[model samples]
Target chain A: MLSKAVQKYCVDTLCIFAVFLFTTNVLAHGGATIENDRCVFRSQGYSIHFTAYQPSFSRTKELCRVVNSLSETIIVLDFVDEALRKLPVDLILKKQKDDQLYADYMLVDERIYPAGTMQLPMKKIEQGSYRLYVNIQELAHQHEVAENVHQIAGFFEFTVTDGAKEKDQSFLARSTWLFYLLALGIFIYLMALKYRS
Target chain B: MLNANVIKKLVLSFVLLTISTVLYAHGERNQEPFLRMKTLHWYDVEWSVKNEGTLKVNEEMTMKGRVHFFSRWPQVISKPDTVFLSVGTPGPVFIRKFSYLNEVPMIQSTGVETGKSYDFEVILKARLPGRHHVHPMFNVESAGGLVGPGIWVNIEGNADDFVYGVETRTGQTIENLGTYATANVYKWHAIWAAIAVLWLLWWIRRPLLIQRYLLVKDGQWSTLITLTDKKLAATMIIGIIGLLIYANGVTKEEYRYTIPLQGGKAEVDAVLNPDEGKVYVKNKKAEYYLPGRSVIIDAEITNNHNLPIQLGEFTSANLRFINHHVPAAVAALDEDYPDELVADSTLVVDDLRPIMPGETRRLHIDATDAAWEVERLSSLLNDPDSSYGALLFFYDSNGKRFISEIYGQILPTFVD
Candidate 1:
């Protein structure tokens, strides 16, 4: 049996450990974060923000993952860096499949887009994951990238849920998950410590 | 003695603090609220602790700021697709020496994310004279300008003694920036003025106006332009013609490689909605202010392309009434002047889900966002007729884009 102080100390340590893990996980992915109620995408260290919506299903819900919806969906990308003005960014989405690693079934594939706010919406979606491929080569480099965008590219993986996983995803929820996890661990540790004592 | 030494130390520290505090550059006050609360939210701002903010005309300084694009994308606003940064004092007060987006010298559009804050460092060379308000401004290509806090800048004097130059590929250093063009304009204006004066003197030497009046008054009056006068006029005309020809020849020879201006409509595939390429936006109807904070629409859409497309955004009058089923933040409208450059969101539907090729669907969509209210679009009081317009954009997984326009009149209702 342990003293109350020891129990509290152990609880605190476990809480701290849980916090560290959760925060590290959240910060693991650079370039994308929800800050102050906004969905921002960071590329080349510059912060680019975007919006995603499905008019038929949601009006206030902004999406980071593709959700299997009963209706059409839309996503908007806003550029904040002038350096991207002349660069031609190519965006393509493929259905993640087992037969092929590079899925050819493109749902949204645009080549050589001018810089600005761009929207990618789909007429329909399935219940699964999606591979969103973004290739950044200056529009001047279009001739070189014409055959393939892999010359200079980075991609983001997004999941398509059945509306359950993304029901209440918000900036606050995503950013504060670590803290919540910490609290949960602390509570569990405290309960265990109390029972042990 | 100890007390005195302590007081002295305190005094010195206070003086140093004052200088450091007031020396940094400041931006406009009104712009701060809008820049922070609206368009682009700034955070984690870091500036040089060294710049106490006084700078010489020829001297350079640097400052940095961060923009945290949040996810509260409102409808009826443009996305910040093309953004610019500059130091201004009512006008461009400092010539940008260098600008780094996220610490890298980014000269073209840079990729960024909403809900993330990116740092920006700007180096400026003070060029203008006098004490002016200095601030940093971010401009969206089609959106309004957003300005930060303005600081008082006292530029002592012009860098009159300073010279600027550029090294040419041919190994020549050209220093004259303005005098070359200015001197030519002055020379042409002086020549034209001199010619006008000479003509005036020649006309005054004879009562030209009176002679013309007399000729009109009396048919028998000798013709004002006699044979000698005609001969003189011909000689002057010939001289002018000869001078013009000589000037044209000299210019043609001097600028032999000049090319005529060529401008016209460019040829490219028109961005059309894949679903609506062959199908028009038919039976379109709208109900705004649903639940007092949203707009709902029902429309018939058909995809003509072999590929499927999804509705991405609906934009009009600089506002993006996007479908927010996914993560989205409408680029804020720059609240500054020059509404044309207000950074309105264009019809780039890069993320509308794919509608199967040759599929026609009747859809009901709800455009919900408090931005609709914050932008005051739903409660516009200026227009009694309450007419408005919007454009619907569609995109496929392949990234092909399409657009359609809509016009409607509103029936204003109070949320109170």
Candidate 2:
């Protein structure tokens, strides 16, 4: 009976976690998605297709995600939204830490680009974990408050390992805290309902 | 102990917050509020074919307006010296044929002065057929594209009849825009691809897997590459090198006039115009956005001039709200006639009472237009700090024009 209850608890927790993931997908594109064999990040109806090629390393191979290769990588952002063509997009790649957006944590070179195909200068990064932030700002209207600048930012996480393995986790493993709360609620409700008789 | 009600409330709050964040992901309107605030202010906005109206495909239309580079230009952003007047519709919804700044053909980069209003006119050929939101965009050499108010344009008809032809100065006609390349790159790329495929096929034709297995098993595995194959590969490599050299020499001769692009920042004056004593906006506030989609602003106006002037129009962003009565006819006889008053009409403004000069008077102004919803002005919605900037145009009895700036707190209107 104890074993069965534990199994039910685990299943319920996982299911709740799945629901949380679906909700928080608004934050990011469930981390990211591969479209047309390329990594495309979609959030808030805006799409930015990401491509990273090690021209100094391999000419034909396209690697979007950082892996075991400690190479000088060339990252390219092919804007899918036409609106992005006019907006100024700034990219910063630095070590993952709190206040990464405001702090001068930029390891790679940074400059605002006119938004067509922005090819960031090739960067030679040592093998480690890092986060890439793409900050996009569009022209605000004349009536809008001039002091407050609203920005749309996209975050991508990557890791450089000795030998990186593939990630194929269940929904429960990759979800927000809301999902666990939902799962726990459902589990409690079910337990109460089952014992009421 | 958390009760079920508390838990339910918590979950509901979480869901609402998540939805709010998703729905209001900040992009254009909210990003760089300072840039939008201090940059050029667009006024006298007019679309040749009225906005939200349908037009036949390939129809030529113009969007004419004025941009005032104020004295309050920020020093943080790139100096706005060399600016190009540009128009964009989501993407390439229309083909821009000609653009004029103050009646000067401004396709190439042009310069504008601070505290000066430049009249912008763009002639667009509707190559695309659909409902498109077109905006007046300005491109700075150092800075990026600064997009203005967008108007919805519906282009009708089939795409087959759209012709994007430009007559060259030398009497040559280039019909297709995309096919203006000089070199026949496609043909050369195809030939190279074919050569590579044939070269790969030459080696794959022989089923050398079984032969290699046999040779390895029999201990005579050193015979994989024959002498003839090596000689042929060497000759082919030498031939490729010779072809590459010949191609480079031939192309260099074919395009001898080609020059590298010279792109650098331009220097222009940020001259601020001395303020001539005119009407000043004092104590301004927007009461509400009525059901008909109009925001009413109660403003106190002080006419500094000697003559009594009437508030003719209030333009915010690209939306126009004109007075109904006093000057029933457009002041086309005014110095800057068609450029300023073409888009102005008496049907927009709510009141037309004249405010006496040197006297401070409170006037309730109603900015009524469908553009409020289309532009998604937050002042009409329920949000804190929805303050906006507006250009108030005052007119004397003699049809003389005097413009003033209104910068004050604007709060979102909530209906009871």
For each candidate, what is chain B's TM-score? Answer: 0.41, 0.62
Return the top candidate by lDDT. 2
Report the lDDT tens digits of candidate 1 across residue range A1-197.
67665566555556445455554443321212223213454443433445456666775345655454646666555554434434666666767776646574464444433324455756776666666655555545334222532343445556666664455678666578778767877776766666566
Using TM-score as the measure, which candidate wins? 2
Summarize candidate 2's per-residue lDDT along A126-186 as a digit string, tens digits.
5666666777665665222224433346666666554222234455564666685787778
User: What's each prediction's clash count?
Assistant: 104, 6
lDDT of 2 by residue, B1-416 (tens): 99644565576567556553433322234334445545667766677776567888888888888787655565666776788888857677798889877777775786777657777889998987899877778887687777666667899998877877787665777786646553478877886898799788878887778888898899987787778778879988998899899888988986665555646433333323354567787646665332234556777888887787888777655445556465623442233222211222243443456778788888877654433422334322333334556677888877777777765555433231
lDDT of 1 by residue, B1-416 (tens): 57633554565556444433221122222122222333554432334423224666767666676554433333334665556665555565666767776666644444344334456777776777666655555665565565543445566566574444555565666674434356657876886688778767766788766667878799846766578767867887887788778878977885565656633321212112234344346536655542234455567778876666677666433334444332322222223322212223233333345567787777665554433432334433233434444455665556555655444443432121
For each candidate in turn, the TM-score is: 0.32, 0.49
Model 1, C-alpha of B408: deviation from truth (Å): 6.4
Error of 2 at A194 (Å): 30
State in Å the error of residue B114, model 2.
5.9
Docking class of 2: incorrect
RMSD of 1: 28.6
| Model 2 fnat value | 0.02
